[model samples]
Target: MKKERAKVEEVSTTEEKYAQWKSQVPVLYDWFANHNLVWPSLSCRWGPQIEQAVYKNKHRLYLSEQTDGSLPNTLIVANCEVVKSRVAAAEHIEHFNEEARSPFVKKYKTILHPGEVNRIRELPQNSKIVATHTDSPDVLIWDIEAQPNRHAVLGASVSRPDLILTGHQDNAEFALAMCPTEPFVLSGGKDKSVVLWSIQDHISISAAADQGSTKSPGSGSSSVKQDSKVGGDSTTMSPSIGPRGIYQGHRNTVEDVQFCPTSVQEFCSVGDDSCLILWDARVGFNPVIKVEKAHDADIHCVDWNHHDENLILTGSADNSVHMFDRRNLTSGGAGSPIHKFKGHSDAVLCVQWCPDKSSVFGSAAEDGLLNIWDHEKAWKAKERIGTRTRSTSPGLFFQHGGHRGKVIEFHWNPSDPWTIISVSDDCDTIGGGGTLQIWRMNDMIYRPKEEVLAELEQFKSHLNTCK
Candidate 1:
């Protein structure tokens, strides 16, 4: 009888805990839904200092957070479905905390100690491999599956890093990009240089290490020498884990770099110098076509139109977004932007072209608004899709404001055309950390205008209650 009583108590305790967690889920979801915040229900334990968030797919999210401006930042991989769903969301969080684990959720403290991670990018072809750049000169490549034992406290299996690429002497690397079709990665730094690293050798060495095979020369070593130099560039080479080719053209800090979506051999870099230079991988780092004075102020972000290879978009500190056509550039002269978008009240920090939509693009600004623009109508006023009154805002299709601070970075889900995730630097309440909000295009656009307005009003009321 006593044994049965004890069993009953244990079952009751488990049920109580689950019930408590389940009850809290709706409250949090309502808070977000009421405000039309569109935040994922799954919250991170680490305070809101998320620097960047990238979606691996519809199912997974990678978030990098910096704590205390120090080394060993936290890398969190979250399950997007578990995050967005109210039904098993709390259970998933509990499982994560217990470290019993879910298939898609995991967190690790990066082993690299040089400085705060400046950027984290998931390889386009291989989502398993993530590249991280720090204030230090090295870019570390971590294999998510390699860290089996990362949750040691949870008694998980152990896994170590696959490779690390070093040799950038620039003070700090602010941008990193991986070619979609090639086994190459690009790093741009403060020293006005961009270096490309080949991953072929690293992959071989990593495979050998995983099998516990004999180490090759410089295998498992943090640094390796450059095998060869291309482009006749001034950057020196050591056999250490250095760049395969060095490209030097930017006169100021390289803020962002991206490989052309359709061509593996072509890539572009934007910088504080207000120059956007396109480079050919085969011809080394020299600019194939340089657009001088691309913006009036520092250009913070650049992205290529997947559908139109010649169309490039840029966002700048000058509070504007500009589009350029590479085919029309004149030699030795600045090319005028074909379309200029003016709406943001502050610096436009980031811009991204929708992967599925050729004519649609999104921009985030320091003004705390994410604006969607369509070139189909604005390309020629006569071809406009919707009604355009004399008083209508030009080029602007939709405006979303949920972040209380500057929206620093945002990305559209490649798998879901309607979804986007945005990260901010701070929050409205004192001591509140940063914020990450997920927005749906359907709610922001396809819904009835009256429905959208009602949700906005509910959100305002929720804010007042929080205050």
Candidate 2:
């Protein structure tokens, strides 16, 4: 046993108080190690850097969200990390007026969902409770002194979700990113930039948010969409998309992003500027690897094929989605999307592929409509079997996700690919004041997978017969 000793210079009282105040540091674990304390910290554990503070438990986490001159959102216990599944433990919405002054919490809340736990650990350093609790929303004004009982408390209505990914300035629409390498959520706001969060080892760290009798008013749900794919090849597919790396190298705000379904790292992005960038996660700044005078107008959405990592698809505000190949850029051929999905009347908001159906991706527009892009018939090659001569058309159930508002975001559930999760606001088609809606695919809907496979098979047989 290594003997760990505390350099205690003070025994007690007067002169010792000055000595202890200056010298007293913190330790992690205290044991009978020759009668002393020991603190353990990571020398260099291979993990992502921590960019922001996060309160967390094993199964959940909470984030502090702040914006200029406006109330912000806080998470109770939110986990969207692909690998580890944490529910949430504690959370708080922090508002700092003056540091040393008695900091009052306008929104101190705690959540204990089933399978979630609340805990705290003792650190030998200067300690403060990271999480807290309140009886109701009006604890400060309602007088915590008068109403001692929490049974009658209620939280004022506001949709404080479990995660806050992006921060904002003056409420402008800021873009945010998720660091797949780090479990933290990144955000950007009024500054027109980005912020990253680190939340891996906050377990048992004191959380400020605590459960209360107050019913949170106007609480609603916000969701993040991860993966979308077009079904292809009539073969078994990998459940997850890959060659995963942060796709960077944009000079402006990235308008749309998509993963290459067939090639894990092969993906594409279009910027607010008229530029298209292609990348492989394993590769770097060279991701300006592919470029095109993609659109005169700003680019809107980018998508990739389930079977071809080289096949890149894009949609733009210019009312067009173009396909390009990796070889076309390298070989200098007249390479572009084999066909353009040219039916939408307004700017396209989102695009995704039906994971179960080949050559199918869904597109949403400002016009409050969803279009199913079926590429099976879009391609017209002399030979069609496993060939890139595939074509695209409208899908059968491309309509409102039961919402009558303008869709801002559309996501396909990974577990159930046909399920579309769309967020729309009051003016569009999301009927009532733009709520997030979950729409189910029609069971009676039809997909021509078997037919496409049969056609490709016959084409292959013809080639074989000729050879």
Candidate 3:
């Protein structure tokens, strides 16, 4: 009975905090949308931009439905209308219903997946081509444009994948990545090994055709062995291909993997063993540099900066984010992180560097907060030690407190500057499956102070003339 009371009190506290955050949306955000989901999603990703208009833009979105066993899991494609910066009025942004679906987003298609989709990664070479991790040892590939849309009802046949990359000895359900420079896939699993595969032959043939390619991505490759599905409906079974290489080093299950932005041969992985290993395929399947004790707890995620090849970011179960310099990782020795951002109060789940800025990054956690930080701020804080400037949290500049539960995953919109899409498992807190939010902070908050002041001064002068 005492524990029940404690649980109720905790829930009431969460409600009060959410109420306070919602009240400040108009003042803190330039544009915002909240869409309630019928089933919780473990992952969300931005797809290719469809069209651009003067006031808004259209883009494809990918997400999943983790069902409750009554029905099969599904892979969903959605079309989202993104409002242009400074175009949405304050009143319009403030009056959204939390329980209603946003008019800006709509379902485009649905694919009945074989299992719960744990992760979705779009190929950089072809955005329509995506890789999904499920409760199996293989990575499933899909061509969203070519796949037939199916109604997600009970007893529906599972959608067939365009290609399958098989390598792991155990379930490869979470750690997955696609190469930025080439058509390659990387995955880690319970087998405690990192696997790599090349889908170049698939992309080459697809490029020659006018319409989307119907050819199996790995059909003609010498390194990849294709096995036809033999079952009740053979047409519905996808062809599977074996991995090119597997690197083993970690003692526990690998949690995440990332490729170096400039090279297909180089990549990195983090695991439950609290180690970060960087591998160079050209130099064989052994790790080039392994940083032991990278975090005090399991590292859940890692991201290599697209702009700065020397910098990498990792988030951990220890409720902290660490920044490491590749050049110094070897020189400074093991466990030498350049800077640590201790902001999240609970386990940090995701961390990614901003696509537009080299020094800025965002971290989401189980604590129901997404904090944006600029590493350069740490140096500036030290430069003002003796002055009147007092710093509380040096690197953190923004805190997104909109979610009432743990933020499962989030992605920065590469097509839209300073915009982000995030999903949370809100069933326990809000009596719903989940909540998906898209928001962009007001420009005045992140822009240079002098520039904002100059613009406001000019606007004030124009208003006086009109009077």
Candidate 4:
């Protein structure tokens, strides 16, 4: 038994045996060179060893291997152990904990659920009152007053939503927009309908429901007083309180709808029919202005310029963004777009006019790129954000790679101009499957002028050292 164990120990290890076999085989260096097939120096441990190798061309090659053999007479692509440096290891571990696990990522404040959030918008001048429309028919009103430290406390403080608005017939509501001045909310869904909801009425009903549950059964005076206080007026409290208005004219699914920043009564709706219909809430279903064939393909989003209401921005599946002038929609006028911005590699999904700057606006596309364009610069983008892979411009000031999937919707924080809230289909959090990511301008690549200059200098120094 001792002699047999010694003989077994004498047998070469897998790496040693592979090295000896490689030395005995004739190297195919000339064949690899002729076909431009260069063997990578970086090694891999577990793969089929080549029993026979033939190079046809740069794009085509032939190989044959045996399941069981003393290793083949081919290039040994050894698996290399990528030992990370101390700094790299720390970064890897930090990224793993932040992305793979929960409680470490600090950017997300609260996780809203029940369904995937389709659209999120804050009430005008009220950052705390966030209205989120989901795949579900109901719209969830979140009161983000308490900021939780741990991931577990994310949706804990936010008990039931402040209010739930439900009027859509379809299962999913795709678009949502809160009135800037009024106590109204507008939502459009796959049902090809737009429903306007009253915020005050919803709140009053919720308050009354809560009060009724808490009041004692026999306490007549107390219950009556509470009912009167919560319900306000009997006329105001309608038993069948529903949507204020339900507008239906779109032949296809309403992709996006937005209220004119200047006129509360007037709003624009775009759908899969490739039409832009301008509607007045007071006029019922009749559209004030309807522009047919808004684009070659389905229109995804539309935004009214905050400064110039006449200027309307529309993004389409045709991979182009058009700037339309409402004034020039006549029989004998400049029929085409005033200016067309075409840089996105894929269909444009969302567009928004800058809250602070009038000339500047941002557009998000299916290619996972956010482009900022200034009207003054015509078609040239002022700055590009998100990814650099498909962008045509070289001046990408800030690139965000946090979202693993397509970023469908993003909104600039009204209160904090530097902060941006974006939602994605694929989120990194374990518990919160699809999450809302809050990005701060300071935290991104947007650096100070001095810092940028310092980085340039450092890069130049490194290049000189390499030379």
Top candidate on lDDT is 3
**RMSD of each candidate?**
14.3, 27.0, 3.7, 20.3
Q: What is the lDDT of residue 76 in candidate 4?
A: 15
Off by over 4 Å in 3: 202-235, 331-335, 386-391
Which segments of model 1 are wrong by more than 4 Å? 1-58, 69-72, 82-114, 148-161, 204-240, 382-392, 427-430, 443-467
Better of 2 and 3 by lDDT: 3
Q: Rank by TM-score, descending?
A: 3, 1, 4, 2
List per-prediction Cα lDDT, in the order shown: 0.63, 0.37, 0.87, 0.52
List TM-score per model, in order.
0.68, 0.45, 0.92, 0.56
What lDDT score is found at residue 254 in candidate 2?
57
How many residue pairs collide in each prediction? 13, 61, 0, 5
Which RMSD does model 3 reach against the true structure?
A: 3.7
**Tens-digit lDDT track for model 1 on 1-467?**
99878856755654465456434533323112111111211112111122333422334566655555322344555544322322233343322221122343333333322244556677777776777666566676767655442331222212233556765776545667878777778878788887777776566655776798854653334244332121012342322345567788899988888888877678889999999888887886688778889999999888888889889999999999999998877656458888888889899988988776788898988776788888765766635644555555466786666554577777776665456667765533212356665545333354447997999899999999999
Give the 10-residue window scoring lowest on summed lDDT in candidate 3: 223-232
Question: For model 4, which pairs clash?
Answer: 43-78, 43-79, 44-78, 44-79, 45-79
Which residue pairs show collisions in model 3?
A: none
- Candidate 1 residue 402 Cα shift, in angstroms, is 0.9
Model 4 deviation from the true structure expressed as Cα RMSD, one decimal place? 20.3
Tens digits of per-residue lDDT, candidate 3, 1-467, equal: 99889878878998899899989999999999998888888999999999999999999999999989788798999999999999999999999888889999999999888888999999988999999999888788999999999988787668888888877889988999999998989999999999998877555545645476455543433223333321114455555656778999899999999999999889999999999999998999888889988999999999999999999999999999998889877622365788888888899999999997888899999988999998998667756674555546678988999898899999999889989999998877767688899999998887878999999999999999999
Per-residue lDDT tens digits for candidate 4, residues 1-467, read 99767645533332254344233222211100001012111100111112222411011011111111222112111111111111122222222222331221212233323333445566674545666665566666655554232222222221234456656777545567777776667777778787777676655655767787542232111111112211223432213235667788777888888888877677888888887777788777666677778788999888888788888889999987888888877533224677777767679888887676676677776654556666764533333433334535333243334443345666553433434444443321122233234333321133346887887799899999999
RMSD of 2: 27.0
